[model samples]
Target: MDWQTTKKDFKRYLEFERNLSGNSVHAYLNDVRKLEVYCEDLNLEIEKLTAQHIQHFLLWINEFALSPFTQARLLSGLKTFFNFLQIEYDLTANPCELIETPRLTRKMPSVLNIEEIDSLINAIDLSKPEGMRNKAIIEVLYGCGLRVSELINLKISNLFLDVEFIKVEGKGNKERLIPVGQQAIKYLKIYMDDIRVHQSIKSGKEDFVFLNRRGSPLSRVMVFIIVKDLAQKIGLQKEISPHTFRHSFASHLVEGGADLRAVQDMLGHESITTTEIYTHIDKDYLQSVITQFHPRS
Candidate 1:
């Protein structure tokens, strides 16, 4: 079958069968398209592709200096695509079956210390009309360890502020309740009651907790830009984004002796392995723990 036809089928399978999010489906398609381009230059047919052609494509992409993590993801996407073909078309063999994924080095996520977090939040210009809204955004992001998408899509109906908890829809449309700190709840109330109540909210957007000046919910890009601007305003050297607040929240919780399972549930991580990255504590803290808690020390 042709590349376009096969890709259309793959998209359907991803959306309906696998139930992947739109962003995930887009990423997988983009990965396949890269290989499709490579094959097109060589006059290779999608159905007739062999393991050797896949290996050559990997080598060619390596010349572009793609990171191992990206390379591994590309290979994974291809493997999934070929597996789908095998099931649908009854292909005798899967070309990606024997292929080896590139070994990836796990990089530690960047985290902000409490002081840095305070500085970044304090740098917000409270004189501006959106100042309390921005402050509440940061507080929710850090205090609740919410993803940017979750923070943007947060709804008024989901907030249980009376009991200090919030229900956020996470990846795969799963919902989780995260405990909100008093500080976050305080700013959220100020934003909702004082600032947001006075604004003319757009129809169908009144339920959203955070909104732009135009009465629309904030976009993910806007959240990233806000975080970037705040970082620059505070002269923070660490390259960070909205996700950095999440990392800081998890790191601080781990450092403060919070249970890993509790952190995992709060962060809405699917696996404990995904949440284990926060266990990489600094050596100074490790030494202090041993000195204080170990009998031999």
Candidate 2:
């Protein structure tokens, strides 16, 4: 079968059987496309892609400037795709089975201190119509450690402010209930009642918690733009994005001596290895403890 046909089948398998999100499906497909690009670079035919071909591909990827973490994820996606093709289409035996992933070194992510977070929050212009909505968005982003997509998809119905919780649909279509902070709840209520309520919401976006000026669901890019603009407004020196809130959420908890397992559960991380990055962030706080308590101090 043509690789295109096989690729379409793989996509269907991911969506129907694996129940992968569109973003995840696209990422997996992109990994496969990398192999195609490599083949074209070498002036080789797609049908000629075999285990030996994949071995060369892996070696080529290693030579690139990409990080081992990103390379490993791409390799994992390739492994899944080939396995799916082998089982369903009876293609040439899976070519990526025996390949090894590069050793990944976990790096600590940057976090905003409480004061920095406060500065960013206060920087929002409250006089404008979108200002209240923006304030609520920032509060919820940091308060819940939400992914940009999660924040955009957040529905009014899923809010449980009375119970101090909110339902978040995370990666892989997994849903989890996270505790809501009092400050976030306060702003969210104000925006809902005073701002979002007055907006002329389009039919489809009525349930969406955050909306654009036209009352449509906010895009992920808009979230990024808002964060970037805020960072600039506050003269924040650190490179930050929507994901920085997630990093800070975990880092702050770890620094406060929260259990690693509990932080992992709240973040909805599938593996403890992914959660271990925050433990590294706590090392600085650990040093402070040592300095304050040690007889050497």
lDDT of 2: 0.88
Q: Compared to the true structure, candidate 1 yields what TM-score?
A: 0.91
Tens-digit lDDT track of model 2 for 1-297: 566887898889999899889989999999988887887788886545677888888789878877888889998998898788778867677777788888876666778989999999899999999998999998898888888889999999999999999999998899999888999999999999998888898987789999999999999999999999999998999999988998898898888888999888889999998898887778877898899999997
CA lDDT, candidate 1, residue 147: 96
Q: After superposition, how far is residue 50 of candidate 1 from its true place, in Å?
A: 2.5
Tens-place lDDT per residue, model 1, 76-129, is 999999999999977677788899998877788998999999999999999999
Q: Runs in model 1 with CA error above 4 Å? A: 282-297
The local distance difference test score of each candidate is 0.93, 0.88
